[model samples]
Target: MSRPLKERKLLVVAVVSHAIVHICELSFPALQIMVAAEILHNPAAYQKLGFAYFVATLVFGAMALPAGFLVDRIGQRRVLILFLFGAAASMILVGTAQSYLMLVLSLGLMGGFIGLYHPAGASLLSLATRKQGAAMGIHGVGGNFGLAISPLLASGLAAWLGWRLAFAGLGLLPLFCGLWVLVDRSIKVELKAAPEDTDNLDRPDPKLFLLPLLVLFLMATLNGMCYRGFSAFLPAFFKLKIPAGTIPLVSGLVQAGSFTTLVLIAGMVSQFLGGKLADRFVKEKVFTAIFLLCAPFLFLLSRLEGIALLLSATAFAFLYFANQPVSNALLPNYVPRLMRGRLYGWFFFANFGAGSVMSWIAGTVAEKFSLAIIFEILAAIAALTGILGFLLVRVSRPDKKPEV
Candidate 1:
């Protein structure tokens, strides 16, 4: 293949893989209400469902570091193939699960599998493509698109064929994706060598980067909590808060799924704008503003209902997803090229691993207080994330490498 065609092909595969990973990530949240009705059958069904989500997401984020190590040894193509096949099997198990425990374990298994995708796919794009920013931006857009589509797709399928088939149908996406990746001749060639092979002799001492990394990771934890808690519960919140007939339902799945789908679509549009801003501005400053802006909108979401609530959610989604690019750019400025793959693993763990616990926390809050209270807590968390960004600014010297 010509270089342009080769890069395009790799981008296509990476985008699809990125989307599939996120689809798996949010699948539980989208189907939570329906799943609860069948499984828990309790008044606090939404609260009960959070444990399952917590398990799934905890495994998903925690496994990224090991997956990163594995990918370096075997190759991105191989690891991604494993991710797809494993995810397919685990998702199929989720469809066939017989009890709540079975369901939680299946989701956790699926998370463990899909967790491998980021390290494999992200490094592939950075290695194979010349325009790293554009490739990463496009990849991030694919993930946002997946987040947008998951509720509609999961709910629609569940409504048509039942929840079992809904999950089973989702399994088919990764199955086909894995098969394509397996057979595609271009992937094996383009994935390239791991970053350690091209390490710079003048790499900065790891010690000097420590404080900034700590600040960034702390910010990541708060951001992750805010992101996961808000996204996971908003559908449930909408289901409870929105007036009937405000939005159409996907069969019996509830109108909240449709509203959630529309709200996340705003994130898809914001991805482009975020990429542009990340390129133009100081990343930490942009990061600060994004999180700070999210707080007010989250508070708006806490107070509003019906059309006003949807508008608030859309605003929050726009600001929230824009942080992806800015945040992704942050560690690269602080870490060496060879160190990036490993550090990025821990970065995601901070974001997802520690952040996964928020589901349970938010769930408990929703049970004890109200769904609106969850967003108010998230508003506070977003403010904290913004404050951490300011700390990062004081600690980081992105323009100058530390002298050995």
Candidate 2:
């Protein structure tokens, strides 16, 4: 049976708040880089800041595969409650650090903590929602909220208390939420397990699993690259191009606005619409086609200036994030359930791992070139992902069960 309205609402609140913590954290990198440059008395000090994310993901990628398997085995609620604190702490440590080594170590530690969130969170959300796109939509929206708000909150707080405070503040959010989830464990959630075909459990089909994994990896790589460019460069871009404090506030607010709106629209609301359409329509092709089309809007938005740029950015983010719920919602249905967590973990790992590389490359580009070139290159990558996403249906197929 589906959860009661009140119960579902509570869960959404928790997940959404969980997402806000990430948003708060993600925004810290650029500001920290800037601050490190100013105080460390060296532009190169910022390299360690980005290195923190790279090193953390390297450690994290090693763990994520196992993490997913463990989620299914141990239960999502327990892991999230236990490990999210590490993530929260990484932020605090990063915030408090007085030296480059401290900053690097703290950031790496932070990535280690972040590594634990998705497997636990995504699996739990999938388990909670059954096969409902609406539920995932709401959950996706929560993540987007985190992504959106992080920049604004970090930049604003960084302006006052220093960027470290943003990290410290965000680091603590998960702890409180983890506590709440712990207290609420007495309540139970029931979901229909993905039906098993025992005969094929070990060796039913190799191709089915490989395809979705491959496609998702590719998509994530492109999107991750694009995301790094946008999130890392946009504020600085805005600051250089726009008026005083305009970049921080406007970039943050616009991002926040786009995130919340897309979640409500594409993530939550449009998700149900996509689901209904998928029931009768040619779902894969249609969805992929729609995704491919987002590039034009993004390209158009990338070229503008001032308020026009902000408005364009809002529209661009909306369209970009809009694809998330639809794409993620499609995965469970295609995969065999038992493999879902593994697949999701690998999916995120591939995305983030590749993305980390992209971010490093982007930073290199920024060092050598300019932020404008970086965004332009990312825009091109987005277009490439869109094209690849559409072709995915022809190249790959989902599994029969949706367990993991």
Candidate 3:
């Protein structure tokens, strides 16, 4: 049967919104260190830049529950519009800042605004698609593209027009997008989910959801650790693996190449198909199992040298991000609407809060335990997470539904 045009259009808007918002947000990261260097006048500006971003993300994660409430109360449209304009203003603030504190404050505000995006967007996307799992994958890919292209585009534009100009000009993106969505007919938030008591999987029995939430929380923590370690170190790793002369371009290209193409595609496929496969196969842990299979692939990639490093890095990037789509895909299915934002907030808190610590942890681990140990830790964590994810899937099974 042919899918209706509206479904395609809704997904396309979701993708476009995801792409633009992320692209605009990420574009600043590459320039952050440079901006800090110029204004802060410190050689350690790079690390501080990372810290600023990390703190902002932590704040964003912290506020997810409230953001979700705002979304539900105000409706996704207005909250989204606020996020868009707020983000743009923050970017402009970032561009015009003359001091370090101002920069930090600007980024902090930007992070807070960006915080409103996922749950609202997730809820919107969830409503738009008949299939949650598939929609999540597509949603995640939009984020991945933002992450992948942000550094590249930001770097290129900043170089051409200066960092300040890049921020000032790119800031206009969300402003324009915000105004458009304010009146866009396509986004019809037709149904507000009725509050229902449920556990982590959003099924009935509020108490039981704790165990699954715990497992998923741990899973999120592990994912955060892997994410922080990899994002923080990949460029350094690439520099070590590749020739010093080629370090600049190769570092960015290696990460971008794999995810820009493969991860996004894999995300949509895994979510949509994983859900259907789970439904048909009646395999409760179907989506979770796919993430489990990705672990060895990530660990194996970290062990290579030279060209092997490049190929392996690419493989791992795709594999690691492949999990993002699946994680959220599992949420709405098991998590009831009322708890969706709260649990999702918990998910981000675990991920980002743990991620906040990972930077310091990795540095310490490298100083004492060795960087290689970090990957080993991630491998073990991913394996454990896969098991928990599978179990969580089982725990979330609806009562009347068949359980495998």
| lDDT per residue as tens, model 2, 1-404 | 33555347545744654484456446555465555665577654334445655665555554567777777777666667656666766677777877767766776666666666666666655555544445555666677667656655666666567666766776778777666667876433344532233224244677654675577678876776676556655655554444554435444434433333332233334434444444344445645665566666567655766666666666566566655555555566555566667777776676665676665666667667765667677778888887886667776553233333
The lDDT of each candidate is 0.80, 0.59, 0.62
Write model 1 residue lDDT over 307-401, tens digit each, in one string.
Answer: 89999999999988888866775566665555555777788888888999999889888888888999999999998898788888887665322
Q: How well is each residue in 1-404 modelled by candidate 3, as lDDT tens digits? A: 23356566666666766666666555544565467568878624445655666666666556566767776677667777888888888878888888778877887787777777776777666665665555666677677676666666666667778888888777787888888877786654545332222223534666455666677777777777667656554544454455543435444433333333333344434444444453344333554665577778668756765666666656556556656665665555556665555566667767755655665555456546555666666677677777777677666545223233
Worst 10 residues of 1 by lDDT: 192-201
Clashes of 1: 0
Candidate 2 deviant stretches above 4 angstroms: 5-10, 42-49, 56-63, 187-209, 245-283, 396-404
- Candidate 1 segments whose C-alpha is farther than 4 A from its true place: 188-208, 248-252, 399-404
Error of 2 at 146 (Å): 1.2
Error of 1 at 348 (Å): 0.9
Q: Which pairs of residues have clashing backbones in candidate 1?
A: none
User: Which candidate leads in TM-score?
Assistant: 1
Q: Evaluated with lDDT, which candidate comes out highest?
A: 1
Residue 378 of model 2: what lDDT?
A: 76
